[model samples]
Target: MSYLRFDKTLMINLEESLPREILRTNKSGAYHCTTIVDCNTRKYHGLLVIPVPELDDENHVLLSSLDETVIQHGAEFNLGLHKYQGDNYSPKGHKYIREFDCEKIPITTYRVGGVILTKEKIFVHYENRILIKYTLVDAHSATTLRFRPLLAFRSVRQYTHENPHANREYQEVENGIKTCMYPGYPELFMQLNKKNEFHFEPYWYKGIEYTKEQERGYDSNEDLYVPGYFEVNIKKGESIIFSAGISEASTNDMFEKFEEQAARRTPRDSFFNCLKNSAHQFHNKQGGKHYLLAGYPWFKCRARDMFVSLPGLTLAVDEVEEFESVMETAQEAIENYINNRPLNCKIYEIEDPDVLLWAIWAIQQYANATSAEQCKEKYGDLLKDIIEFIHKGKHDNLFLHDNGLLYSNGENKAITWMNATINDRPVTPRTGYIVEVNSLWYNALRFVAGMMHTGDKAESIFADSLDELAKTTAQSFIDVFLNEHGYLLDYVNGQPSDWAVRPNMIFTVAFEYSPLKPEQKKRILDITTRELLTPKGLRSLSPKSIGYNPNYVGPQILRDCAYHQGTAWPWLMGFYMEAYLRIYKTSGVSFIERQLIGFEEEMRKHCISSIPELFDGNPPFKGRGAVSFAMNVALILHVLKQLNKYY
Candidate 1:
């Protein structure tokens, strides 16, 4: 049995299946996302969603869905599911699904009276195409299949309604037809491997509702355009491949293309492999530059996310070349930022105060994965430049004080990653001598000092100066951040120090070089484990802290308010586990391994084989936010790597 298989009992239940979404992405920023039972609960769900540079930077949903009908003996069973208004589901096709499994690719089995059919779907890598192969497993009599394509030519951020400006005309192609609903949009080419008949019947399917959107306090209802259906006959053992893409493909080679793509997939047959497969989906290649997307359903190439996730997503999986390729692009962005020139790459927020610090840490991880020598040979200059850039007071917000600690001005803007905004103002504004930022700063200084202390005389002299600066920074870090309560303060501005217990202090113990004493580190970890640790991860703020909201739900403002207050973020678990193992060594391995049980169960939960952005801080700890998050997945992989070292 497959590790991610769903039986009929779960597949037929709307409540159980609708929340379980499946996502498939091509390396070129195209994806196919929907529920396990083929129902689109969100406007972001689609059969072919791709990025169109001419239209905008956002992804557009071209083919919303494909409704399939099985016909025999003049009886038709429409096997497509869509939620309408008033909690109504048209056709209710999920009742016919016997099983759904996605070990290698998404495969669905359907049983209707005397016929058994199997549907397998795959997204072609590095291309804007989706291929679905339908096989007739067992049939007593001849059967015919009908396919109707529902089109939504709009950005994922917006919905489309019935408009008179839509072009209902289509051009006939080989065993298919191509149509463009708008002028700037690319024409959608939907073709079948075998000969089929297309009937020109353009109609509008109105009032299709997305429950996920409504629950999030957004507009939910939209209309989809259907441009007729295609009918094709099938034999008992015959298989037909359907292709949907931005460009036309050869009808004769569709079967071969599908097989080639399927062969490249890594089977999600186990917990580790599931994460490994999901990690590869975040790779986006555009304009000869490689980038790591922050998440699926809605996110882009954010600089902080890329640096934080690069090592675990690549080196942990033993993909050394990919790590170098992505870093090459990031290196360019860092250089451009320092030189005061426009970044030619696709990365966003390169000027964030902590991004450069995270970049140095990413290179440090590369050193840990391979060797310090190899890392220095490749990225030594970049590391030196980053340290020099910050030391010379070149950054906009990050200022080096006389105390040797870096301070950031987050009073106006959300400078750090805890950044949640409302009405263009920060909600949890952490300013001046933040815990993680200074911890990262100290680690970077010490690391560069070690890397540059080798043979060159000038480099050795620079390393000595860095050592002196690190010592001063360490003394000030203990003085300003560590309070009398045995736990570190979150941040220290002009006002009374914010002594809230947060996951930010975990970095002090997790880094290889730390400013805190061993006992001081132990006291912080004890406080963290007691107050902020959850089965999912570490909470942003302790429950005992005032203004703590444990759940992330309701409208936009409410969700934003609770986003970082007390929500548990899985990415923090990586640092927490590292601190535990570093302090307790082999004695803590068993305890840390058992802590991962909750995350293992999540592999079969929301967004199968992937990790979500966060979970509620309260009981049940249900997943919320983006379905598949890059940093969450990557850090978990890093933890797994650390565990293997113990064995």
Candidate 2:
């Protein structure tokens, strides 16, 4: 169990950094181009920003990837203010809405892929769903700088969308150069200079070092004054390509100016507070505990996502309501997900699968933390609904799998988040074979038993069943899910799966209700730490495996091939932390303390600001977002709750 520690007075105020210091890798194992970028945003997701390249050459500059689109904005969105570009406002002139701007927009590597053959400084800053790639020519003598705030919202469109580049799903289409340069919406620019507002100093974050310039705040003010961002430059010939969405502009004057304001100003909110604030944002206003699914900050209505994201949001946020609400929201969501049942109707906007053990784990957290009154009053309905869903048996007749596992079968059906495939091919199609599902099932049962009370027959039965399930899981699932040496396999059908060591298996090795023995836990953790762990997070699969993908971007098939094949998933780091804590608490290994302490240290270097979705598997690996993934960071904060040491 974890505890909470809140040091509200501790503030993060980052001052400066050399843009050239940023070196990022793309999904294709290729060096994305670089520019001397000066970008500042307060939040990790970068709601506002001011980005432009300090480039050395003007003629050789080739701009491609840029994010220009209308997101949740203003008065009602921005707390009611006159927008930028109002009669009294000014529009940002240097912004470009792609497709409408120039050349082509391809999903090949990035939106734009070419070289800048200039002798002047170039700075480019923008936002979007796609990965940004820049390839510089050697002829240019320039120190390049790049700025990327792990931005990209989780998407769950009502319908499937055509791939940005390749229309087909399966194969990586390595062909032509189809481009779209149509008229599109400009960036939103909002009015600043408010007497009382959330003011942000660009590029400031928690737990990281930077140059600082600060003025003490007075309680007379509303809250921490968070402002948008401003960039300071010393380079010449620096031109930034500000790009985003393609569409007809809104007639709303407010929207028009907000767009203009957005192009000019960049959001440089505080990642320290943003990390804590974003987590707290998930709960309802009244605070009893109910999830927003995804909030306006990203895509909305993701129940399972919200539940799994609870640890991240609720951890150390200086609020307990989020914890209560999350339990309530998940209770509602589990029923919803099960009601449409298990067919592609998951609590998420994406494919519905049976891997809900991920969400169930959150439910266990709720039971462990919080009060009984809170649970019964707010989440009672949710709990009953979820338990009913489980009792009814969704996929694999899991209620009867008695073998202690849950899974699915068939071609197009889903059983986990790894449902996406190249074209028609399903990335993970394990029809049978017992697995981590049972471990989650057992944990859920034990969790419910505790929440239900001591004398309840159902509670006793659930506890008894938990023991049985753990036994069955250990007897059957262990060997089935693991390879000859005990490293975990991706999954199990009848025959052996490629026997690859994937991060998903880390759940069993890491969680408190782990199905593995003490020895088994040790081996798996070592393997994970050495092979699967990257500077960013845990790789989906071993890099040495045939299925491994060094890069994170490319054709659907290529990306999916790497999805569980090798791309690193930062979200899993929380569980990895959980497992590390479990091992440390037991063996009393001094190394465990280092892991506990090191988790935060690593975060300070990589994920300390906010957790990313996935990272490239290769050297100089960069982060890749499967969805607007920020929950894992929150989860890490949640897991840290158990620490005895001071943060």
Candidate 3:
């Protein structure tokens, strides 16, 4: 049995299979995603989705899906699945699925009587292309294959209706055809490795429903245009390759290209390998610059997510070169922010108050990975500049107080990572001295001070100032955030401290430098474990807290409200585990290992071999938000790295 294989019993059941999605990315901004049965349950699901920078920032769906039909003895058996209105699924191709596995690439086998066909899919790295190779595994008689491509040349966020404006024409290319639905969109070039007959039957497949969208209270219906069907003959033990891309390709080399791409895939054979593979998928290289995408399907390169996830995604996987590549781009963005120039890179929210702090923490991880000397030689000036930037009050919202704690005026904005907003106003307003922000601030100051003190500048006045300021900040942190309940307050504004039991306090215990004593750290950790910990991860808020919404459901407003109220985020587990191992040493290893089993079981659930953005806090803890999240995958890899240290 393969690690990620599903037999007919699970593959044929819509209720069981439809929710389990699979995602493949090209390392660029292009991707191919859908359910295990090839049924698109979300509008974001597609066979070929790529970013159209010429049009806009959002990803555009080019080839929505490809439906295959197997012909034997003049009887056509459609091996395609589509959900329509009135709880109807036409063609019902999932019933023919004998097995589905993704250990290497996503492979689906269908048995239609005596004919058994296998389809394998791969997204070509660094290109906007998807290749699907169909093999006739077994056949007793002559067989034929037909492929119908459903096109939806629209933004992933919106759906297209049956309209008269669509171009109902296509140009014949080598072994296939190319078409463009809209004027501004790029032409979708679709081809096969062998000769095929093109049947021009342009029509609209209307009223296709995405049940996931409906459940989330969004527009769920769309009309996809089918240009035509390609008919080709096949023999037993022979394979044919189909390619869909934004640009044209050589028909003869499609097979070789598919094999080359497959050869590069890190098989989803184990939990760690699954995480490593998912981590690499988040790497988006564009315009000769490297970046880490925040999450898949709908997310872009976010500054906080990029820095926070950078070390684990690269360093924990032993990809030190990749770590430096992303940092090179991120450093440029930070420089642009400091110089008050427009950021030429694609990183979003570089101006966030805590992003620089997180960037310093990433460098700390690098220091641990290699050596303090190497980190100082490479990122010393960058660290000094960040601390100076904060101390000099150069940031717009962040201010340096006389008592050494950092304050941000997040009155109407969502400054920290609890950043859900309603009508542009913060839903969970953590305005004043945020616990995590100050915790990270103190850690950065202490780490930089230690580095500066030990480096060539042993008698540096700047190092002395940092050490002095760090001590002051440590005292101020305890005075402002630590409450009588022995747990840290989420944030303090002087009006009335926001005493929500959030995961934000975990940073104080997780970071290398801490303001609290060992007993105090233990107290905070115990409270966090008691109130916020869950099988999925640490919940954003405690259930004992008021306005705790445990389930992430309903419409946009409702979901946003629950985004940080009580939603469990897996990335926090990275910090929670770090704190655990640091405090308990070898004794904590077994407990942490047992806790990781829940995440390991997740390898076969939801999105296979990938971690999601968030999960419901309540029982069942259904994975929600983005199907594949960079932070969750990276942090889990970080935990595994920490675990390996004990062994």
Candidate 4:
């Protein structure tokens, strides 16, 4: 039995299966997602979702789902499940599911009377295609399968109503037919591995309700266009494959290509292997450079996410080439900005000073993982170039203060990672001399200085002024940020320090180059462990803080207000583990290892085989936010490897 297998007892029960969703992504930024029971409960769920760069760099759901029916001896059974208006389920196919498993791919077994059929699904790694193969496991006589293609042909974020503009005609392709619903979208090719007859009976399936979207207070109901159905006959032990994609060429060697791609996949024998596989999903080629998608389903590439997640997502996994490529991409973006050229890369709408610092820190991590000399040989000049940009202040409002802290002022924008704003107002509003920014600043300066210090007088000349600045920053950081309260302040403006007990202080100790002393690191961890640390991750704010929101719920405005207030972000767990280990040494290894086990257990709960973006701060710390969050998975793998280094 596969690790993520579910029997008919659970599959037949919609309550248990509806909430559990499955995801399959390709290297080309296409994905297949839906609930475990082959039903789409969310608008983000789709059978063929691909990126359309010309359509504003967002994923478009060309084909929502493909419903199948089994016909035998003049009897027909629909194996498709859809929720219509009035909370009714049509063609409740999930009731016939004998078994379901998601070890590597999603496989569902169905037994209807004397006929038993097994269906398996896989998405092509480097192409925009989905292949579903059905085999006649057992049968008394000849049986037939009918496939009805449901096309949404709209942005995943939007819904489609019954429109006259949709083309009702389809052109014959190699093994099947291709049809284009919208003029701007690509033509969707619905082909088969074997030649079959195409019956064009176009109709609209209206009032298809998306419960998740409704719960989020958005337009939940949509109308889907079913162009036609494909019918084919099969005997016992015979299998048939169905393909769908933007191009007819994607169907070439469908089965053989899927097998070859599946063979190259990393084994999901353990939690770590699953995470390693998930790390690969975030990488996509865009703008002529390798980029990492922040998360699955929703998030696109962002500068902060790229830099913060680079070390864990690449270097920790021994993906040296990927690490270098990402760094080069970041450097190219900075150069584009320096030369006043079109950015054309992943640049956050609000430029983050800490993101620039994290780039330096990520390179330092790569140098630690590999050899410093090797890092210098490849990224030496690139690091200098980035440092030069930071010093030159290419980013808006970012400047090095006389006190050695990086300062920026913005009333309505979030400058740091606590960068969630609602209705034109910054939530956290960490505008000036944020705690984490300064911490990263000191670390970056010292780290790059250490890298440059490896050479002679001429080569090491850059380290002289940087070293002095880092020294000044460390002293000023302790004076301005540290206090008798036993924890570092979250941020400091012209007035008194905002001494909210936040997890941002942990980075000051967790980093390889720390500004705080040994005792200070211990004190910071003490407060962090007592207040912010949860079983799943680190809380954004302590419960003792004034504006702590334990539960992240309600409308967009409510959720945005609580985004960084007290949301327990799984990515922060990495820094917490690092800080705990740095202070307690080997004695803390088991503690972190045990905590990692909790995260592994979480993979079984939400977004099976992946980590979530955030959880609630209070008890029953339920996983909320994005389902397949990339940074959370990357950080967990990176920090676990870091802990293992001690042993």
Candidate 5:
């Protein structure tokens, strides 16, 4: 899920490299320290430790992924705002500055406090002023884990860049640099002495390097990483300020201006808490979740992704009644898509098909949380239309399948984002029956059938049909999807479908409205945990999978191949947690509880910021790809809500 970086964009923080943080294991065996850093701030947002850690001064050292391990030091931004987008430019403002220092910061719990709850505070040991916040939020409350992780600053300095090409588009007939200011810590800052420094620095993943002497030197066209250095003195009993604004040349000005702007703008926690509370209310009363973050799909202007996250974000925060309203929104979106094709006649965005399944999966959650009468009465027409649309295949109904799986390609093929591609190449390039889709279809049918039964239509027939469909699904599609290997195929209908273990089955296992039996659910959990589970979350595909991409790099084909190949997606952690809960409720909670107790701490540790976008599966592993999705945030809120169960 996305966290607020100093840049102000809700993006992923894929910069955790601390072995302990990235390893997902705490110093002691019992707790897993899920520590996240705001890659930009280089400050600890919060942390999760299993069995809890006995906080010592050492525990307070903010760990960084990019900090050269040899140097063992950390860095922070001096944005006039105290935040940074990348090390290169001002956040959305796109303006740039060369310096600032870590000084006073503001913070408080968001609820009773102003829109931004955190107020400035000072610490003893480090003597660095930083912001601190304590919150129940939505996710972790279900479990009895108290988060007391602290964040502080060690040191940070600034270097300026002379980029004449700052705003100029590379492909837009651009020549000569479009100059703009950028604050960065390059080798030039690094002291020749290695002892008092962090060995590592932020290399522009795809950046041009420069030398202080060569601001307009002969090496003008060449991009180089000018070495830089600085120091952070986190002496014992010290703290650093976590400023509300960024680290621009004028920290005080940015703070004073943004503090007022922040005051005028929508409150940070309000936006977050609104999404959470609204979702929680819906889940509690409606019994289902609005899977989409913002709005829903199809006609009437309600989009697909928007509606699904409604419950997860809205309800999880506090809006209980909106659950039904969101479900209503989903109804309208789905019905319009089926009957009218407003979203897409084929529902294909580029060359992928997962969005459709994701939308359907959302509806399943919506139905589960709402009353049969409410769902049927409000969304009866919408449900029928969606079902009819799924049934009505392309090419004038000539491409219908008995089992109900969508095929973007001619055959019963699979091509979702996970298996999608572009430029005649697959981002995922999946070709065959996949696992998540069919499972979603089966779940959707049962939900619609049950809803139909509740309607004034012929109930008995729909119920029996649903039962038959369930039986058929249990016997055929399941076996077809899952193989003798015990691992589910990334896709079927191929000579040997890729037997990649992923978080695909979490939905079927997690959702109360799934089509799996007790034994099958147990198996799904076992496979998922063994292959996909990581301290951060579930990886897109197991490293053991042949197709897994170990590194994040290259062109569209290369990147797309790596997209779902072996990326560890933290967002899936919520689903994995939910599925684990479901399995425990049925069987005893032994294995699941064991996993959860350990995972509770693991979830929090080493996550740069609440969550990093993705991480390398290898040790001393570092996070990569830095854009967080709302669902990941929603998942955290949901998990937190579940934590309240213990209380």
Candidate 6:
């Protein structure tokens, strides 16, 4: 039995199948996402979602969905299902689905009377094209299939309505018709591999309800334009390919292109294999430069998330060349930050100082994987420049204090990853010498100093000076943040330490260079395990705290209030596992493996073969936030590799 397949029982259950989603992406910033049953439940769901440089830098839904109908013996069987308003389902085609398998490409088998048809889909790598192959498995008579293209040429963030600005015109190109509903957007080309006739009938499909958006308390209804349909006739044992993309050239060699891209993909036979493939999806190219995307369906490549997710997504997977390229891009971004240049921050924003600190940790991982000499040879100047800049206090209010600790006045802003806001106000307002920032500061200094001291080309490149600075910072961290409850304090200023129980304390014990003692590490781990540990991930805040919000529900304001208050974050599991192994040594393998079983099951639950961004901190931790969260996927692969080292 395939772990990623749904049987007839589950496929026919609309309530169950329609909620589970699947996502496919090409590294060129194009994605295909929708329900398991081919029903779009969210506004973000689309068949050909690609970035239009002419518009904003975000993705626009060019081709929303394709409705296919199989006609046999004067009977029309609509194989396209959609949920309308008032819980009404149009065509209700899921009832005919016999099986759904996501092990490879998304393949759905349908049985209409004695006819058996299979639909397989894959998004081309490094291209904005989606190829869908439909095969007539077994049929006694000839069948005709009609496909209607649903076009929503608008930004994914907004809903499109019936408007006069929509151009109901098209041009024929290579046995297909190209059309653009809005001006300045790329024209969408819809074509078939073989010869087919395009029916020129334009109409509006209105009142399509995005249930997921409505549940999140947003406008959910939208209107899509159906330009026309493609008609193709097929016999038994024959197959046809449907191509949708921005460039008409992609329509050529449709079958061969599909086969070529399929061969290039990493194997997806197991949980780790699936995660490995998903990790590659995060490495995207924007404007001729390679960068790691933070998450899919929404997020861009920001500095903090890119650095935080870099090592796991690249180096941990043994992708050295790509890792080097991503590091180069990050180094350039750092240079842009250091010079105080007004970058196109909309593309790759740099706000958090922790991201710069995380670069040291990522470099340390690279050094451990390859060699310290290799790191210095590749990024010696970049590493030295970052350290020098930090020492001189050139960025983000991060300056070395008189007490030998790195201090950032986090006042009136949420600088770190706990940056969730409601009505322009921070939720977890950590506005002092935060615990995690100082921990990262000490670790960054020590890692750089250790590398510089032992590096082959090292001739005392401020080696002793950085070591002394790291020592002072580590001592000050222990003296200031070590709370009476055994775990490190959340933050501190001149007054008493804010002893809030948060998962940020895990980093103090997780990093290679830690300030805590062996007993202190154990106490921190035990406290986190009792209060913050959940099946999905470590909670951002402990439930025992009065500030904890159990439910990550309701509208944007309510959701942001709970986003970091007590919501469980799957990416934090990487640090939690690292801390576990650091304190318990190899004896902790069994405990770590037990906690990972939930995530393995989670791969098949919410987003097939991937992890979501956040889950509810309370019981039955349902996956929330963005569906195919990149950092969560990267950290899962990272932890699995770490576990493999011990087992």
TM-score each candidate: 0.99, 0.55, 0.99, 0.97, 0.54, 0.98
Q: Write the per-residue lDDT of candidate 3 for residues 1-647, one digit (tens) a residue.
A: 79999999999999999999999998998899999999999999999999999999999999999999999899999988999999999999999999999999999999999999999999999999999999999999999999999999999999998998999889999999999989999999999999999999998999999999999999899999999999999999999999999889999888888888899888889999999999999999999999999998999999999999999999999999999999999998898898798889899988889999999999999999999999999999999999999999999978889889999878789988888999999999888888899999999999999889876655377889998999899999999999999999988888967767999999999999999999999999999999999999999999999999989999999999999999999999889999999899999999999989989999998889999999999999999989999999999899999999999
Q: After superposing candidate 4 on the true structure, give the runs of residues whose Cα lies further than 4 Å from its correct spot.
A: 250-252
In order, what lDDT does every prediction score?
0.94, 0.41, 0.93, 0.84, 0.40, 0.85
lDDT by residue for model 2 over 271-326, one digit each (tens)? 33435533433343222334343432223446456657775677455456656554
Greater lDDT among 4 and 5 belongs to 4
Tens-digit lDDT string for candidate 1 (1-647): 77989999999999999999999999888999999999999999999999999988999999999999999998999999999999999989899999999999999999999899999999999989999999999999989999999999999999999999999999999999999999999999999999999998999999999998998999999999999999999999999999999899999889889899899899998888999998999999999999999999999999999999999899989999999999999998899999899999889988999999999999999999999889999999999999999999999999999999999998878988888999988998999999999999999999999999984999999999999999999999999999999888888986987877888999999998999999999999999999999999999999999889989999999999999999999999888998999999999999999988889999988999999999999999999989999999999899899899999
Per-residue CA lDDT of model 4 for 1-647, tens digit only, reads 56678899988999888878888888767899888887898888999999887787789999999999899889999999999888899989998899987777778999998889999988888788888989999999879899999999899889988998988988999889999987878888888887778888989999999887876667889999999899888889988889898888545587787678667767665788778877888887765777888887988888878777888888878888889887787877766765678877765542566776777777788889889999888778777777777787776767878888888885677777887888777888887778888888888888778888997786588988789989999999998889898899888888876778999999998988888889889988999999999998999999999999968787778888888999899889898898888888899988988998888886566687888789999889988888888779888988878876888
Candidate 2: deviation at residue 256, Å?
24
Candidate maximizing lDDT: 1
Worst 10 residues of 5 by lDDT: 185-194
Worst 10 residues of 4 by lDDT: 345-354
Task: List model 6 lDDT by residue over 1-647, tens digit each.
Answer: 87688999998898788779999998878899999999999888999999988888888999999999999988999989887889999988998999998887789999999899999998988888899999999998879999998999989999999999899999988868888887899888888888888898889999999988988999999999998889989989998999998889545588788788767766567888788877888878777688888887898887778877888888778888888888877777777778876554343547576777878778888888789889878777777888888888887678778777877776677788999876676777786688888888888788777778865445366777888887788788889888777888888877765667999999888988887888988999899999999989999999888789968888988898899999999889888998898778799999988988988888678888888889999888988988878778877777887887886
lDDT ranking of the models: 1, 3, 6, 4, 2, 5
Candidate 6 lDDT trough over 10 residues, lowest sum: 342-351
Number of clashes in every candidate structure? Answer: 0, 89, 0, 0, 142, 0
Give the Cα-based TM-score of candidate 1 against the true structure. Answer: 0.99
What is the clash count of model 2?
A: 89
- What would you estimate as the lDDT of candidate 6? 0.85
Q: RMSD of each candidate?
A: 0.7, 17.3, 0.9, 1.6, 16.0, 1.5
